[model samples]
Target: MKATDPSQPRERALLVQVVLGRRDRREAEDSLAELERLADSAGAATIGCITQRRDRPTPGLFVGEGKLVDIQLACREGKANVVIFDNELSAVQVNNLDLALGIKVIDRTEVILQIFARRARSAEAKVQVELAQLQYLISRIPVSRKQQRFQGGIGMRGPGESPLQLRNAPMRRRISDLKRRLDRIGKRHASVRKRRPWPLVSLVGYTNAGKSTLLNACTQAGAYVDDRLFATLDTKTRLVHVPENRKLLLTDTVGFIRHLPHGLVASFRSTLDVARESDLLLLIADAADPGIATQIDVVHETLAEIEAEAVPYMIVLNKSDAATQDQLDHLLAIHHDAVVVSARKGEGLDKLKARIVEELLAHDVHFPGENDHG
Candidate 1:
């Protein structure tokens, strides 16, 4: 099959499946909706979503054989060209699914990597994404090395390069080279931050969590706010007026997702530097979502992975108009500093801005501009 030719017809339609292990059906549905968002981000028109509830995935196929057959039938009926799994699939799983379904198969990790690959604008971002893709490809190398011998340098290797020649030793060297280049970029960013005396506030949370909406609400930064996941792939900083018209830089950053590939986290580290260096972080949670807690945990873990957890942050529960009282109460108990707001309706926005000012002042009270109200 050469791993490139398609046994099935290729088109735009996609069949997305959400894999739930020990999570409630409601949560699974919420996560499935997120997968649809990812598909939309990747330019796939989602036809249907299938959720498989299992305590554990099948060894070879992500879902049980019966479920796989059912999904295959659905794909055939829908004439879908792409099948996206909510979980990260092993290389063998991807190959097995491609063989069984005879269609292009992509897991959540691949979907995210695709977004990073597309949204990366700067050289640093590009390098980070390539490094992450290489790391991911390194892990997912098929067991059939003979078949993959032809696929050499298809993923991890640079333009027209072959991995067979360098083998493991040279591959490690390239990884090290990428790290050193990223370090230089990081140091330059540190120098820029040191020059700015104004406090920095960062927006962080699950992808499509309306962090961009809030950023626009407060700063009128006009950050790209599409309904799709990872819409704001690159972080953009704009000066925002807090309480009393006080100004501070607000950075809208990349959103996090559950089970995000480690390669992605590593590659986006430079982009996520804005979040790590912020004086205050607004961890936005989609209040309208049923799986808000799980999404929050994903963001927290990602922050920890980037060593950004030490930065003081408050929860911004977005989409409050679509949220129920129970959901709001449940989240409020855990995040006392959290504020529920609908960025779409402009409701609770004043309070959210006030909280941002309070948090910023708690750390340091310095008027960057002419006003001095100490």
Candidate 2:
């Protein structure tokens, strides 16, 4: 509600979750906790949280009328200016909720899209994020255009300087044009890959699991790294040099997350396709996260969804410096074959590199000398 700066006001958000059948209270809490992190990543301060048990989502509102009233009271009492839903909401549902709550209402997918829109730096990533954003907004346009609209921040931020909401006809044209442009970009990337004479290896992991940090540690690629979720959206390939002058191409890719939207998966396939093409994948994970196993499972599920399951992968537990000895041991004991490293502190990287060399050699590709990857 406070806005000294119109373009970048601090959002005070109320987190909401609906517990459907079969998902217990703990699971719902875990999800809400994750959503809170997402809100924080989008530069919002969480002011309150509300959860409701529902047999099924009410047709127009995700929550029951009583629960909706409860939420209204919470929003006023807690002074929340925004509401972020853990579950995906229909466009109509979002519209109705916005009217009822008297604030911005966005679902999980929109939050993820907002992060992608802001994090995208390269031309390719920008294109992918834009196309995805357009696809998402095309459906929400009719509902949004009818409303008196809350402006600027989170779901409102997107590619370029243009206004986000556009006419359906023009927006469809934009989506098609973006798809074609992305297709060309994907083909160009493929052509470049064909020209490169080294084995391809990509780093895949949950968001903010230190893939870029590992990349910088290994190849000194100086990739952009941030502590927030979805920090690096661009695909960066750098040549990793091992002993005896043998080298392989290493790529840092966008990180995966639990419940990553299906639309995002389709839209960013051009970027994610790198993992599918790789001879080997370094499945990175944060050693400190108690949810490390679940995060690893999500990455594996995403890889399978992208048809990258056939590719051989090694689990690399990174950020060992942040993890307690007990945590590290717990992970290592569970993942006996896993490589441990602190990409930020430059610890255990040599051993990780040695494993990489072994894995790449197993694929049996001859490396050419002194070529810096792009």
Candidate 3:
């Protein structure tokens, strides 16, 4: 699909999803809601949504023919310019859908890539986003080329190469270049980490779970905080002082979400290494979000995927000021050792820091000497 024009108004999006079984109805709805948030984050206006239940997806269009007609009519009624599917669409599926609906069709992965592309600020982040985007596009090039050929656009390609080859070659080269750049940056980051004297502590949690707020409150690092999914892409590290004039390296990392793209995880492995290498991890979670338990599970699963599951860590139930007493009690019952804190209102921060000091000291974690305070 062509990139939406920034000069034009935001494209209206119609979200589509398929419920595989009766038991998956709630999960499918939640996934669709998240896709809507992703669309909003990518600057798309959601005009409507459609859901279909099927024992399994249709190989051709994903959704059945009758559902496609309903979607087409809904698109006309809502004036939707784009169709966003909750599930990952295969290249052939994307091609068929575009031919059937006569509109841009994308899946959950593309929406996430779009958000990452827009939110990437640092050079390393930009490189990582581009690499993932290139990889995703390369996977779909075959079907795209087939469609182009059917439309008689193959003859309009550059003189020496077919359309597919012309598009894929440069993207492959770009991916190689990006990898080289990222490797250099990763080496630089590793060297710096080696020279640092403080024990590293990384804050990890679901997006919009107040990890950045806690980082700012604890370290006075002034990291940007936003109440949006994947608000912080770049890792921010700061020196935080505890009791006895001891200092620790506190790092804030990009948040995890349910069903995060594997490509993104691989591409951001360098950044995520902070969590993997940390002496202690502060698993910050929102106390008020109804999906907090599931969010915690997703964070844990992501950590395990990155080989950080065995790292010593502490659970921190944040946003205590906003959570009801019953909510706090319920979470504490489940995570008995967790420290409750409100990073935004400065509630329970001292307790959290004290807990941090206790955990690090018990583990005999390293700290800079007086002369190494810088």
Candidate 4:
């Protein structure tokens, strides 16, 4: 088992996706397309993609033995050095696939973890990413003796121990250490929040929905903004001045995606506590994306999982400058009170700020103020 050299050429990747029973064909295609984008984000050149319509997944190979053979052939023809599946693979499936395909076998969860590992900058974020990666690895200890020989690759590297070291008690001890560190950090964050006098507002949205740009527009926080998926993994907070000399704490968090890994959600609980504890949620959505509706649903589902669904939130239809009139109308129809804005051009930000003030005032009127000891 050896580590891959960074100076070596990028791997050519072949993507595999399954359209399970009763799944919409269009949605399946869109999911596969997103997987391709994820592969690209992780520095892989996507040579080709293979999809199968199956009644259900095969227990051992996931895509069935016949489909697996086809994928192997596709990998050979495409000269692909790796195969990425759009669905999460069980330990058995991954082991069988690696043996049959004779290449690196990874899933959507691993792809996302790789991107998170690369994007994490803050210490807290790095800890969270490492914890999630380790948790995922613990569940993926290969059953086959030959599969255990697989070395570090794109999805295997993390902030801490190597994938090979994660097969035993050392990995458990590392996980415990990470948990304790994160618990300490979380308590510090909680104490800081307790001392803040201003009301809290958090930005929640799908990846590349312009939340970072909006944060820059509103408070000039100057967060690193990129056009790629999961570009902003660290949580950023800034003081935002509303009307009447009032100020509120605005926090930006990692974006949500369809089929987000459960391990990530659990590991990032502390970071997402900003959303759960916020006085108001500024739910941003990309108005220009055709899949905006589905994206919104995914965000809502994730928020619910974090117990943030009960919090007061407003839908923000961002990227208005790039959105068509029809698209805006459709979103407005779905979320009757959604605020429309273009965060990149700083369009409609004043109205957005005003709306924030209005929402805060409304919230204060309904709930007890921080100063009210009663």
Q: Rank the candidates by lDDT, best first.
A: 4, 3, 2, 1
The CA lDDT of each predicted structure is 0.80, 0.86, 0.88, 0.88
lDDT of 2 by residue, 1-374 (tens): 77577445388888889889888776577678888888888878898888888789998989999989988998899888889999889988998999988889999999999988878888988989888888888766544442434334558655643344443568778888989998999999988988888888899999989999999999889998988888888899998887767778999999898889877898899999999998889999999988888889999999999999999999999999999999988888989999999998999988987888787767664457533351
Candidate 2 minimal-lDDT segment of 10 residues: 142-151
User: How many backbone overlaps does candidate 3 show?
Assistant: 0
For model 3 the local lDDT of residue 310 reads: 90
Error of 1 at 8 (Å): 20
The TM-scores of all predictions, comma-separated, are 0.81, 0.87, 0.89, 0.88
How many Å off is the CA of 89 in candidate 3?
Answer: 0.4
Score candidate 1 by TM-score against the native: 0.81
Report the Cα lDDT for residue 121, model 3. 98
lDDT of 4: 0.88
Question: Tens-digit lDDT track for model 4 on 17-62?
Answer: 9888999888888799888888887889899998999999999899
Q: Among all windows of ten consecutive residues in candidate 1, which has the lowest summed lDDT?
A: 5-14
Between candidates 2 and 3, the lDDT winner = 3
Location of the lowest summed lDDT over 10 successive residues in candidate 3: 150-159
Off by over 4 Å in 1: 1-23, 49-58, 144-165, 168-174, 324-334, 368-374
